[model samples]
Target: MSDKKTLQEIEKEHRDSHFAEKSMQYWRSWGSWFSWGSPVGLGLFFIETAVAAWIVAQIVK
Candidate 1:
């Protein structure tokens, strides 16, 4: 371990080296799931509930 490097210096160096790639990787991973898959998932859930409600209505009537 180099005793000359301060904590802030080490942190700054690590952040500079990894921040962009790490941030981009995280955003890219979530972006597709949130933008596309979430809506599809929600739509399926809604349709399923609607169908259940229709079945209940038919049974009651």
Candidate 2:
């Protein structure tokens, strides 16, 4: 057998590397904005939920 990667294998590797890079970029740029662990993100989420609940309560009354 020859020591060579098939075309599909090469393409898969390239695609996987691209995906990993993009994922890292996303995490660095905007992931914290939506992450529950971040204080700002968590605060925003709680505020939104509270507003929604209040609206529902008003509608149900």
Best by lDDT: 2
Backbone clash count, each prediction separately? 0, 0
Q: Which ten residues in a row have the lowest lDDT in candidate 1?
A: 32-41
Estimate candidate 1's RMSD in Å.
6.6
Whole-structure CA lDDT of model 1: 0.84
Every candidate's lDDT: 0.84, 0.93
Q: CA shift at 61, candidate 1, in angstroms?
A: 0.4
**Per-residue lDDT of model 2, residues 10-53, tens digit only:** 99999999999999998887877778898888998999999999
TM-score of each: 0.41, 0.55
Q: List the residue pairs that clash in candidate 2.
A: none
Per-candidate alpha-carbon RMSD to the true structure: 6.6, 3.3
Candidate 1 versus the native: TM-score? 0.41
Report the lDDT tens digits of candidate 1 across residue range 1-61.
7679898999999998798889899988877665535886577778889999999999999
